[model samples]
Target chain A: MTAKLSPRTEIRLAGEGGQGMILAGIILAEAAAIYDGKNAVQTQSYGPEARGGASKAEVVIASGEIDHPEVLNADVVVALSQEAFKKFASSVKPGGLLIVDEEKVDSTSAPQAIRIPVTKMAFETTGTVALGVLVGLTGVVSREAIEKAVTARAPRGTEEMNHKALDAGFTAAEKARK
Target chain B: MAVKLMQGNEAIALGAVAAGCRFYAGYPITPSTEVAEVLSRELPKVGGKFIQMEDEIASMAAIIGASVGGLKSMTATSGPGFSLMQENIGYAAMTEIPCVVVDVQRLGPSTGQPTAASQGDVMQARWGTHGDHPIIALSPISVRQSFDLTIKAFDLSEKFRTPVILLTDEIIGHMREPVELPDFKTIRSEEYRVTAPGQEYIPFRNESGDVPPLANFGVGYRYHITGLYHDQVGFPTQRLDEIDPWLERVNTKLDKHLDEIALVEEDYQDGAKVALLSYGCSARTARHALKLARAQGKKVDMLTLFTIWPFPERQVEALGERVDRIIVPEMNLGQLAYEVERMAGRKKVRRVVRANGEMVTPQMVLEAMEG
Candidate 1:
């Protein structure tokens, strides 16, 4: 095998019921692994019910072969629920950043937290169904290594919505930074 | 340029379409239903056939019948339904049919978890059919692989003239990922030997005697095929001598070609002392464990078995001599580890069993390697 080194990034999302956290992780991983020709591993954990249960999804994107599908301490965690925030905030590495939904999380514990209205955007986009798009957009706005992932993982024939959702997240993040 | 976000199940459906699979028969099960659902919608567009069988047994039978009718066919099922389809799988082996079965495996001995990730079916995919038979099972770690490997499963089934199973877990089945839809091209079918121009054709034998070149039914090859021991002409035979070799030949063709079928990925295997071995989703965890072990200055290597059937003896035997211990972590209660210890000898094999429907994490494998 010819040797080529690919940079690696781990993306994680955690939230309560119906936030599409798992969908976000899968879209990011698959887009990179399949479309960008990177190696990706996507995994998820859900407590029980379809409504109001703790849910978390992790994606490990690597240019080379992915050694681990399980990400113990994420380089990035997007928490969409208060329960998820309390659960996943400490799970991120000290240097890692935490993205949370402003409505759900108080944002007092996290030293470096970026508040994004993922749930509100999800509702406005297409009610609860567009949560997948919200998560997809977050992947696009990550400013990490997942931009390639957003373009790669969009639903077929939904390029317009994918672009709009991603731009929304990016603009939202940029505004928050300012 | 269709960059659609597809679930692993939907990808398998597209793969079945791309592989020229004209027939699909399956019952809806959690995680695996998307495969059936997608095929249901797409098959008609391509003038293919799709049937939601009454149960998995009928589903398996329908697919086999479709294969015999000169159509590439498949079925998808989860743990509970997969168990229902085992007997037909055995029948397919005896009849030497070419087909594919996708098992989006959920946790189970019996409905353990309806929609959770589990590698518990590793050995079940090999031996669940009962009786001795060779199996070709390909597993995918990513959603894209669910597509690519589904196509490969069909190719192998046609190549070996045996039923191939794409063993995927719920995680890989439900997880959506980006997949590059390859340019559509005509996939060539293997040459079939038939009774040409008013001659007797035996569906069970070929010129090379390797695999009986399968002829599609109603293709001018009027041959009878029954599960019982049969003569060269495809007629059932009662003679023990004839029966033994018939079984032997089917077994030998696959066994002799094991090298061609065995697929494994060796990571840092050179001059390694400790062996961290795994397959399916567990392979990823083992890779992490191997890295952690290496960082601690421990000599470790990783052996990932993609082709679990026929148990890559050559690789295992060679690795067995060099490693101090082979640490195997899986989501089941020591199903595959039993075979590993059997083939690699008992002294150095270790089993890290996890049966709670959760993944076999890296910590579990690392601790076992250190232990």
Candidate 2:
């Protein structure tokens, strides 16, 4: 009997409408497709309202063409708000990583979560929600790919601050692993 | 040249620029508004022109006017706005103006859902303008195909000297993917230019071929244009000799060039008993279902239609001969399926449809396959 080596990676990012989660998904997808030379698709959902409503973006990166673009059971889920954390906590696959913003999300019920002070770190460095979770998912992606993508896709004049946010996220993930 | 992650709407706008389309006039409508927004930002950089008109009606008129001025022009809209632009679109057809209209469809008999995705505009695109005039429509199934087919839409519009419609639903219009676009210099189609000067020019004359070279209005050419059936010199004519041949030429130009304008993708397994025919958003579901069916040891062929109008009857006829059953899944209820039943026999056709602004699932298609 033969065994499969690597399966497709599905990542879902959930937050409020103004947190730039859609842009974050695009950055991650660009990293996988343009930098790593894989196939990636990014789909997003948001309420009619432009901001303050629930928003979510899903990214699927595969070594081959993706048949279904939507994420069925996400391999990694990042929740940036209490509502999103409650909604998507159970949709992660078994043994999958569930990342929550410790300062903003109430993780009282999820002991298995890898909680990080993402909002605080991002605010201190970039003065915005800088997609620290995307940086944390570099364990699945790569540091170089995320770095290049962040540098390339970020808005003009914010490159230096976004790089600092990326460094902070990488450091936080390493410390959590310990 | 460069690989970039782009939304499908953004890619279409860039593809238009790459195809040497230099003028865009559109009114903003949901799911399709981004096409206008991107062009507003990108057009001026390429020395092209972009104008947000008072409404979709004027937007359609402006593009037609720009095309008559010898610049390739285009517009984008959704259902309600598309409904508004039909009159001018018919005018463009009657005058044989070469332009492109992109309808990034959303759910609607009337404003059903602003942001939701649906393939409900297939029939509207084919029969929207209230005439039996010739038109071409293409539906793209993915973000990358959206870019490629938008270029093809311009190419066909210029080559045939007729208005071409790109009928895309919100799903493919909004999804983001990484694409390596072709160089603009390499992919651009040749622009139309007048061969003769003043008094020697005939605006609608086809001395050698079916299509006549269009001359810009101010470029030392004196001619008249109207929505009425006109003679080759562009004047309204009541005589059958002038009117009948004009109608014949305008209506049959696309039919004569079906080989070049009808774009399709076919994946057939030898001796497969069933084939799935789909386009736009539903093509995504059809492909996934085909993969699932193959995994379960079923033989199913797939055909993805890029060109939806002029019907691609040649390819449909060929597929009908090889397969016993044909399955069609669209967002609307049996719109394209009705045509499939006609070509492939009603007894051999199966339809799976939904119009509630939600995608048809792969499991739904698989169950229909098993049934």
Candidate 3:
């Protein structure tokens, strides 16, 4: 199903520092801007801790120039940790999509969330499976664009596994829709 | 060139190489360390030198020395490191050395926050050197502009024979966007040329123009360089006759070239009564607010200042006369707002400021417009 997105779509990917949410945000933005010909701006913020502290990456995808780069009110927000969910679930716009990690974030605050075991999927496949899940569920960018972006950005020797993870994510999303 | 996603700091590093900058000396700091990291990898591939100095003070000294030795040089740092660089920045100003200093500003009177963004250094970029000397500072609001302005900083420094500051904040420094860079072969950098012969070369000559051609140290020309007031021959002099001419030339050089130096973008609507004036990241917010205001049928003009130094007094004064009120939004309390008030009158300017490491939001600007 093709996702109907606004002219300007603001997405927030948030998790603990070492969860690679920042890299996932970068990959998502690259898929939209570089591979799909849309304009994108990505900005990030995190605590001083090298790992485990709260971290977030915001991506603004637009058909026109992106001003005010940060997410004012997110159209899409993916929270991979309980802390991230608690902190950012309120920031999602009304009727906006909220995706959360099924096992990591146990919260009823956002009942409309599409729950998925993204971290477990990554453990079974590649470290960037969250990116796959997000794109597969939202269709923010085309599948081919994300494939090319993952190939270009994923680490050497991890491309094959990452592609498999993306396929798995598409399947999971399909199952969730049913 | 095809469009590629690039961060502001990485664009700056590559832009320096494009600008013919061959020497880089800097200590790594958050939000700006990417510049040094990228330069370390890229500078050597182009037959340039990159050195990680012991501290910011030494980094400043190293770039100055490299520039004096006839290479376009640069250094990038955050708040604390930028603070350490002030004394040498002044020295470079006094000596008329051409170099670029990139301050990817983080919050600070001291080290406030390493990753958070702030525009608190606006005044520091202008007067941090502790003298009446003229300074040139440019701020970029986007990734592409960061690359473009870095090259402009080098060109202006070499043409005017003074240190130029790329005064960016952590927001723009770390933000990533798609940019299609120009062809490297087409990029050109301004070079210093000595017109006078070996015996007639004067390092501090002000006879023809405010700026004189500076001779490289290893070149055939020999001259003294000092931080103290110097005469035409570059020797220190306490004589008022010798010092007065030097002061006039150094301080008035940028003023004389204000037309060329002051870079601003003006977006005016027919008969718009209110205006938004901002720079750097805050300009992005103001632009967003302008759109929101206009969508609600409010008439507003927007002016984005790329050149933050020399104050752009003429433009602000004219804007003040045309607009009923000017809303100034920045990350600091009232740094540029003070200048706006000075030009536009206190009653005509409204300040929207935030210094708690968060951006001045578009909502804040919208509220300011209402007020």
Candidate 4:
């Protein structure tokens, strides 16, 4: 079943510090704001450690002005690590969407979650594949918008690779939906 | 201009450059470090100077020195660094050096949390430095406001010849929002111009307005600047006549221009008996709560203060007279609420406060409204 979203959609991307979740959050916000002409605000919180600690970035997208720049009850939660899943899964609203990395997060506790091998796909292609998977599953932002944002923000010499990774994510989402 | 998604700290750095800021000296600190980082890369592209000072004290001193040498200068820091810069901040005020200090407050008292948000420095921003002094503190509620307010901070500092504080918190500093910045050519900042020739210049002469024209050092106008009480020519003095005038001018300069300096947004409904008042990150929460409260058929007024210092007493007192009660939500333990209470009366003001590194939720403010 397709995930239903509210007028104000709150998305939380959680992973380890080095996993580029913060960057994913920024790209997602840009996709909604710059490309789709929606209002978006992205805020992040991480541990003091630079790496190997739980980090989460939240994006609040709305058709109107976003007064509170944080996720009160996340409409979509993407967890790429077991710790992230444990910490943020409960924050997802009832009947909300949860997409977990199948290999990294063992149990989402929500049986209806859409599980995908996000990190493995990133290992095979590019590290930004999870963001692509998120957009594919929820379609919170248009696919073309996300692609443009990712390309605009991609590192030098890695745009093509990241584009391929996003294609793989969409393919996986298509299979899961079927 | 195409809209670009920019973080609040990054917007501040770009805003500084747009406001004709030619020098940045700051020590890296969480949340606020992005301001220094962006400036470090972008300053040189515009023929501006950026220095990674050894500490916040040195950073504060460096900005003041640059300003004295005739550059629009700024420094950014968190709470600990803000504390270290207190003495130099007072020095800037005493000498009437025009500079901007951006304080991205985190959970504080002393390095309480490196990555959390707080409005704990509201009082500190006003009175952190010792003694009575005039200060202009502007706080922004959004990333776009962050950019706009940073430029205002510089303009106000130059126009007032006083140190201005951009007192933002971690949430507003790190959050990202899409902003279409105005063209650089369209922006105007107050420049320090000495109309009087070097021979006829009196650095602190209160001849016309409260703010006397300042001349950059090494520009032929040689004058003494000290932390001590000074005369019209900036010379050190102990006499009552010289010190009294100096104190009067420095203290009341900002007060005379309260109409121009106090920036606030007032949203009032017809015959609204309740009002919501807040600033900085907390203002965002209050705005959300105002919508929720109004949706539930509550007549509520909301006031968002962009300029926090020099208090904006007249507007707030006027608000107090109009409303039966005012609610304040802030990410601190009643710092600004105290001011609201003093203006609106103790029984007429209620506070929804949090100091635990998390924002004051909109629900909390809504509950306060109901209570």
Once superposed on the true structure, which residue ranges of model 2 sit more than 4 Å away at CA?
A1-6, A102-114, A120-131, A134-138, A175-178, B191-195, B198-201, B205-209, B238-241
Work out candidate 4's RMSD over C-alphas.
1.5
Off by over 4 Å in 3: A1-4, A124-127, B195-199
Clashing pairs in 1: A30-B178, A31-B178, A154-B5, A155-B4, A155-B5, A156-B4
Predicted complex 1: CAPRI docking category:
acceptable
Identify the runs in model 1 with alpha carbons over 4 angstroms from their true place.
A1-8, A26-41, A45-54, A62-64, A105-122, A126-178, B1-7, B143-145, B176-181, B186-189, B193-197, B205-210, B229-237, B295-298
In model 4, the runs with Cα more than 4 Å from the true position are A124-127, B195-199, B206-209
Against the reference, the lDDT scores of all candidates come to: 0.75, 0.84, 0.90, 0.90
TM-score of 1: 0.83
TM-score of each: 0.83, 0.91, 0.97, 0.97
Cα lDDT tens digits, model 4, B1-371, are 68999989999998999999999999999879999999999999999999998999999999999998889999999999999999999999999999999999999789799899999999998999999889999999988888889899999999899999999999999999999999988998656656345467878875434788788887787789999988898888999988888888788888778998999999999999999999999999999989988888989999999999989898899999999989999988999989988888999999899999999999999888777
Clashing residue pairs in candidate 2, if any? none
What are the per-residue Cα lDDT tens digits for candidate 3 across B273-334? 99999999999999999999999999999999999998899999999999999999999998
User: Can you rank all candidates by DockQ, best first?
Assistant: 4, 3, 2, 1
User: What's the distance in Å from true for residue B357, model 2?
Assistant: 2.6
Looking at model 2 chain A, report the run of 10 residues with the lowest lDDT sum: A124-133
DockQ of candidate 4 is 0.92
